[model samples]
Target chain A: MGGSEHDDGRNGKTPSAVVGDVDDFWAQALVDVPRETYVLRLYVVGNSPRSRGAIRNVRKLCDEHLAGRFDLEVHDLNQEPWLARDAQIVAAPTLVRERPLPVQRIIGSLSDIERVLVGLGVSPNPAVDP
Target chain B: MDTYESKTPVGETITKSTNVLQKVPTGIKGFDEITVGGLPRGRTTLVCGSAGAGKTLFALEFLVRGATEHGEPGVFIAFEETAVELTQSVASLGFDLDGLVASKKLAIDYVHVERSEILETGDYDLNGLFVRLEYAIASVGAKRVVIDSLETLFSALGNEGILRSEFRRLFRWLKDRGVTAIITGERGDGTLTRHGIEEYVSDCVILLEQRVHERFATRYLRVVKYRGTMHGTNEYPFLIHAGGISVVPVTSLGLTHIASDERMSTGVPRLDAMLGGKGIFRGSSVLISGTPGTGKSSLAAHAVQSACRRGERCLYFAFEESQGQFVRNMRSIGVDLKPWLDQGRLQFHASRPTLFGLEMHLANIHRLVEAFDPSVVVIDPVTNFEMVATNAEVRAMLMRLVDFLKSRGITAVFTSLTAGSGALEETDVGISSLMDTWLLVQFLEGSGERNRGLYVLKSRGMSHSNQVREFHLGSHGIDLLDVYVGPAGVLTGSARQTQEAKERADAIARQQEMDRKQRDLARKRAQIEAQILALRAEFEAEEQEVMAILEQDKRRELVLGRDREQMARLRQADPNKQQNGGGAG
Candidate 1:
């Protein structure tokens, strides 16, 4: 997560570090909280527009519905081809929900929030949406 | 050659013809001959065999031959053996792998596919192998490629679908690069290749079998399928030795060998008389079969003597006896082979047939015949070949050998030892059909004696005698005496002698009776003549006496007649008178 900064430039959906201590506190809070936490990984081909759009859409969906209860990781397929091979990644901009039991995958920019939420097993609350 | 050059279609037709799956010669001895050229070029050939069938060695030798002899570079992608181990294993075969590698004519890449090292997190293909193979090929500019065993790769990949698709891609890649590739595979149960690659590499599929028959192991190679080419269908025996692998094609030369019309003597004059008095035709194969101790070897020795006496080179392969022993034995029978052997006209090569594999024996024979260039080659008792090979195998070997010799105009004689006296119809090797002349010798046991009888069973293009002659292995040599024809049948040995004696005795009795009849006729004629003379004399004397008597008797008769008349008259008169007087008194 500390290496999440876009040092190689040309980054659109750059990850924002919001309080390292708070993330640690959330990390501890994850054990105490009775809520289930989700682990997600997003694969992309560098910082392309489609990759950035997919990243933005996934992050917004997780923040709006499952904030502080989800862990996200991003991988540039070009930089880690072996990882892509290991995951059998045929297409880029793939979001794979790893944890919370039954794993799932969603391809393309992840624009449809409801479909992305359904694919990731995240039930959106109307109150949280408001 | 001129016709082929003139009949050539120009341009696009040439392209079309070349595109018709040209064969790439594998350069292995007898292999190219079997395939007529070799496997389909620019295509994959699957070589499947069980363990110890020399599958890896075959693939390696293909690459090696291609690299060294054909001037075509090769790359060997070994899946089971490392490059060093492979090199070491083939060192004894006189292949300098390191030197080939150094000169860039051959490249060996060991693709170590360990199942333990592979973790299938997801579905994967063997792209790593492809990259390595491609690199190896490019490194050597190889036109020939070998993948020694795809089974290990399959085990490592552990996905049949992915492996199959990857194999298809790999084969296509090899073809796209125009490489004649050999893919070695472990034999599956009832399948050509363990990975079932035969379906993919259907262009050519070769199957190798290592069979242990009668405690002797022999390796045989067969082309299961060859597309767009005519290949020998019979299984051919192959040998792996210090000179590398040699595939002995069943009859590689075929019937194309030109036959000679020349003739040579069989040494035994009477035996020669049996074979149309000219022995067998030069370059023709002759088979001699008989029971043990029936002078088959002696006949062969006689043939050797005849061949050598003609100042022609002779090769005598004696399986049962050593050269020294054979020479000594033949000398005792008046076949002094020692002089010919010393003069270099006769070469005696003696060895036990069990000393090596059947193919190796054939190879040795081929090598020796080529080196010696013998005009006559005599194999004493082809039955010895039966000890190492099957009947079919021996026949095949002899067929090839006969073809080779006949092509070179070499007279070949084979003596076979039958199990007993009964198998006159076929030799133990069952190669009677290959012989141009077949001489059957057997024991003619009669009158409590065993005599050797020789007869010509068949003579393919000659008028040979069919009579069974008495084959005598005397102190002077083989003597074929005329068999005795009598009431019982054709008699030989003492029976023949007895029959002859009886015939002579009957002829002498007939001559004496003829002489006695002539003497009796002479004596009877004399006696008849004397009796006739006496009769005549008696007639003459009687006549004389009659004449005399006639003269005298005529006189007397006349006198008597006269007397009679007188007497009669007197008596008649006197008596009458007396009677009358007495009557009156």
Candidate 2:
């Protein structure tokens, strides 16, 4: 896929997990058993520095752990504009998790790790990590 | 289906078969559930209450509910509150009065009545009110009319007699015209409406009150009298929230609570065990009655927090304490309702009883119950509510409410303040008969070291252990200890030896007792006085008749004298029966 994070997210325990954007599903990321699994397709326009950072950071974490726990497919919005249409991406960098229920999308640069983790398919940190 | 039903002639049904059909639904949440349908098709219902007891809201909501929910056009005629104020206040309640008014589905008329503003009897016959009402109603082709309140114009008129006649005329006119009207009135002491609006509007009269006792302000509603329909006579607790006025008429006492066979903790194992099977059934009414400072509220709060911890909705209606103080106080007991409130599962309806009357208290409770739909409800010290209702009647109300709630599957928790030192238990204006579980949080004063105790006095239809468990109010919350009951009941007083022995026990205790006694005495006195007044009225009528009789006797005597003079003239003419006694007879 286009340099996205994990592939075998269906089994969970992915390090570079992409959580959904909905606030209520935050705790779902930390659970041992996976309830909701999504086939996330991320859209980035022309591989900008922000896009490159997201791809590198996300892939690095997944390889160190999950490897095949989740599936992340990235598409360049400018190159395959038609793919963006399928995911209903209005902006350059968008995350569309298309499975489970209620197809969700998040339009942001995905800099905040907690946001990224919560937005993709990952659980929240159990403790505050004092 | 009652008194007037049999007596009054079956009036011609106004809804003709050919009339276009549409139902007007009053989306008062639970109220609609209670009414089965809504306010009678086209009959008027007088929603009377004291100032600021949410009379206007009740009427406006009826209008808004009719307009939006069921597509029934509505007209709101304001007498006291400005349109802007009504909109602003109701908007906080999540109701957009302006939008409804603008949609042309609703019409609002702000009627400003000034006594000085040239109101003459010859020209004015409530016609101004009628004109404005008609205009608004016509603009929307309204099926509902709410004059909130109708009495403002009457209040402005110094000539009270004229106001009474005008009220009769206005309501009659409305009835004839066929518009379901809700006329708001200011509640006086006795009558449903001030200025004796009760005599005329006997069909349906709903009384609302806002009482402030111990600095807590709450509202209640009661159907003082409903003519046609059979409704729960008990005053329903209501709440004025961000939505609108909500009335809770939980009048079904459970003779049929399914013993869940479920055991829940009282937060303290000992106390829980004492409450039989280690806990009370879900949706049961747990009453904690005790003298002041017996950790009643804390115990109730403990239950609430426990319920919340289990992720169930919990609501606490505190009559004595503020939300913060309640939270902080319960913090000692380790019970927190704040989290659930944040999650929209817990709600605290705190206000003073004196802020309204018994009806307002009932209405406030009703409103809160509807809005919260709490799995568990706690009224910390319903003694304030006792102040508003008659002991026997209050019990009846409670019984009905208990039954009502049990049917809906909700647990209720109440803390009753037992006044007086020798009080075996503070009898709540007769609400004991209605309680499902009675927990006595007594204060024992033996051995010079006063201590508090918690005991399960009684639990109806359920087995409970009869043991006194010790408890104390500390920084954390109410702590329950298994200190063997030394015979003396729960005690509360000084733990530390003081120097001067001053502070002669604050006015809180004495004042409440004094108030209770004073209220009793005053009620008795008023009853006696009313009886005496009635007798006096009868005697006055008789005396007036006697005086008239004496006057009649005097007039009779005068007539007799004239008769005697005519007889004398007849005798004078008897000379040959001179010209045939023409003057004799």
lDDT tens readout by residue for model 2, B1-585: 111012322344444422532223578755654554556666678888877888888888888888888788888877677789888877887888888888898887776555433222111123334444555676789889887776665656555665666677677667666688888888877767776777777567778777664455556667676655655665556777656766655643337766555656666656776776668877677888888887788788778777877878877788899988887767655666677778877788788866766545665666567677888888777777766655654565566567766666788887788884765564653676667788887766655776787777788766787666667777666666655422343333442212113223545667789999999999999999999999999999999999999999999999997887677665785655535544445
Prediction 2 TM-score vs. true:
0.48
Question: Relative to the true interface, what fraction of contacts does candidate 2 keep?
Answer: 0.00
- Candidate 1 per-residue C-alpha lDDT over B188-242 given as tens digits, one digit per residue, 9 for 90 to 100: 8988777788888867899999998777888999999997777899888898877
Question: Of the candidates shown, which would achieve the greatest TM-score relative to the real structure?
Answer: 1
In model 1, residue pairs whose N, Cα or C atoms come closer than 3 Å (at least 3 residues apart or on different chains), thus clashing, are B381-B415, B549-B553, B550-B554, B552-B556, B553-B557, B556-B560, B557-B561, B559-B563, B560-B564, B563-B567
- For model 2 the local lDDT of residue A2 reads 48
Residues A1-130 of candidate 1: C-alpha lDDT, one tens digit per residue: 2112323222133234467677766666555333556767777765656667777877788788877667788886655645654553433466666666455656567777887777676779687653
Computed on C-alphas against the true complex, the DockQ of each candidate is 0.02, 0.02
Error of 1 at B581 (Å): 67
Per-model lDDT: 0.78, 0.66
